[model samples]
Target: MMNFTNQISTATDPAKIVDELAQGKAEDYNIGFLFVSGLSNTAMAEVIALLRKRLKVDHLLGCTCAGIIGSEAEIERLPASTLILGKLPGVKILPFSLNQTQFDDFQQVDDWLQFFNVFPNENPKFLILPDPFLFDMHEFLSGLNQVYPGCPVIGGLASGAMQPRENLLFINNESFEEGIVGVALVGNFSVSTIVSQGCRPIGQSYIVTRAENNIIYTLAGRPFIQVLEEVLQKATARDRLLAQEAIFLGIAMDEYTHNFKRGDFLIRTVIALDQSTGAGVITDYAKAGQTVQFHVRDAETATEDLNELLLSHRKKEQNKKPLGALVFSCNGRGENLFREKNHDISIIQKCVGPVPAAGFFCAGEIGPVGGSNFLHGFTNSIALFYPEEETAA
Candidate 1:
């Protein structure tokens, strides 16, 4: 049997929030933890006092983020908090945190693996939460891959405007700005991830007829700069405005093409556009013949993207659909980023039915891409949990 429970609270006191969640927890939970954060700095002692006082568990782990999300509201927006208690038998759980100085000393992740020397559990799926201030996210991902090739990594940068100088990050009990805190689940328990990019491209797909390192110089045998101008020239004044606001590039995953369904595109952010040469720089390293398209994100695109993810999930041939979903979306994507409040939270519940779900708006997101997962930004990744019998196909 698989089950989870979630709670959302507006009480500023950690203890108050914990009491509410303890009531919601299901009886079957074996191992679980609570992830908490808000605009205020609630010390570990205070957070622990609350957890120990209210909930029972073999072990617990968590960190602070820029904000918290449970239900439809943000904790920072009010005195809000979110919690999820899980039930998983025969599972391995390992938790760790790292600092900037540690990252500097270690050229490769090989250096850090020594810190987690035990390899406590085999075939572990890692859930990472870096102190946004201390860790170079790119290096952190690379290091994990080096040590545990093919391991699934999830979670996001600790949220907040908390920058290097401001210093606001929380892990377990300690607080700092420069390190990351994470929990790695190994053995017995299985993890299945769900990603809701919340976007649908409208532009026609085109081939990257030419390109240089990280920069695109041509498309469909046309000058990269020229094609871009043509797209803008053809756009309506409104589309032109939205394009300037949040334009992205979609690189259709070749893997998706094989599905014989809709085209699959792994979206990438377009970091820059050179008016002088009509070229663009993208987060994805482009290659020849790869399908590329101009994609725009707005309230509509996000709505469509989410519906697609949920629909696809329901359509899966699995014996069971998702019992619960962990929704980690971009901080820029919630009510603050959309035209409406609670849009994502509502869509999810409507489609999946309210199974216990918990997560916060993140600085960046983490999930899969073309069979390999990467930490993503401005995207929504949902890890849907189903019965082990479903995965046994």
Candidate 2:
């Protein structure tokens, strides 16, 4: 079994931050994680070079992001960079790149595993940094589910670019423009995923009685519009006002669950309403017989939901602390949604007691919900790392 050691940084001066971190006692470290905002694009080449020289790790993975998260702060729309250095004793890390052509040629898990020299029994966890522009993420995630069942693929889509091929991904000291760059961690570690979609259910759960593709015509034997109207009428004044723009629909991924709680549902945006037919349009496919509920998102609910989830994780783990965390938050969060600046990361630190963490504001986040991975918007997907076999001590 191996112990975990890490350090996190958010500094404006790339060279100075790298220099400070390079001075740390990191001789046993095998992996380096980095995320930076576009403000440092002018000097990214130098940044990567310095990281490679200083970290001296077997794997170096990162990307340019809309914002950088580190320690207890989420730095948004600013020039910032975050780095996490880890010493994974007995862990095997394999880094790879995927492009449009490789996606087509990709057929089986063996094709991916051979490059990493890993077997399915190794139980690898993936850290994905995908370019939202070129990758058909839905299809890619679906394929991974079928090929590598029960493995956690956690990460965020690279943001900070408005158009295709504008974002950058880093593997080792090299940078790429149009592909996915990620690493597979196999052996002697445990990874737990926490995906907070940032919504709480407003009304009782209902079964989708009628639906077509992404449109929901009815719920629990009534028109969708009628159900929504009832929910709205019952909502408090503040919730009603928030419902006007911030309302969402939570599709229960496990329909059999008797009580659908906060994390049980996969939250999707309520895009539009068809008054003529009393149907509701959702961002994802809605099928008959699935459980559904209306959800609302405001600063208060978002804050409470995040805090509750983090506290629950703490209770489950009891006295054991996590080594670090990687947070993939939505671009819609931050001051745009909360009145405060360090809202999400601050709450995480409050519950977990300030673990070494780093991440970015993603255009779309990727994590498992109801035992499967999906591309989600307006979510805070976090992965907590644990040392190997801690109970034996």
**lDDT (CA) per prediction:** 0.65, 0.82
* C-alpha positional error of residue 117 in candidate 1 after TM-score superposition, expressed in Å: 5.7
- Cα lDDT of model 1 by residue, 1-393, tens digit: 667767776666666766776775535554454556653554434765566546665555555555565644545444456666666666656667778776678865556667765352366677766655656776667666667766677776667555663435444445555677666765554566666665556446678977876898788988776776688788778777877887777777672363322226677788888888678899867888787777777777678878776766666733244666667778888776676677777887776656567777787887765545666777877766665534410
Best by lDDT: 2
Candidate 2 global Cα RMSD: 2.6
lDDT accuracy of residue 252 in candidate 1: 71
In model 1, which residue pairs have backbone atoms overlapping below 3 Å?
Answer: 66-159, 66-160, 131-179, 131-180, 134-178, 194-382, 225-278
Cα TM-score of candidate 2:
0.92
Cα lDDT of candidate 1 equals 0.65
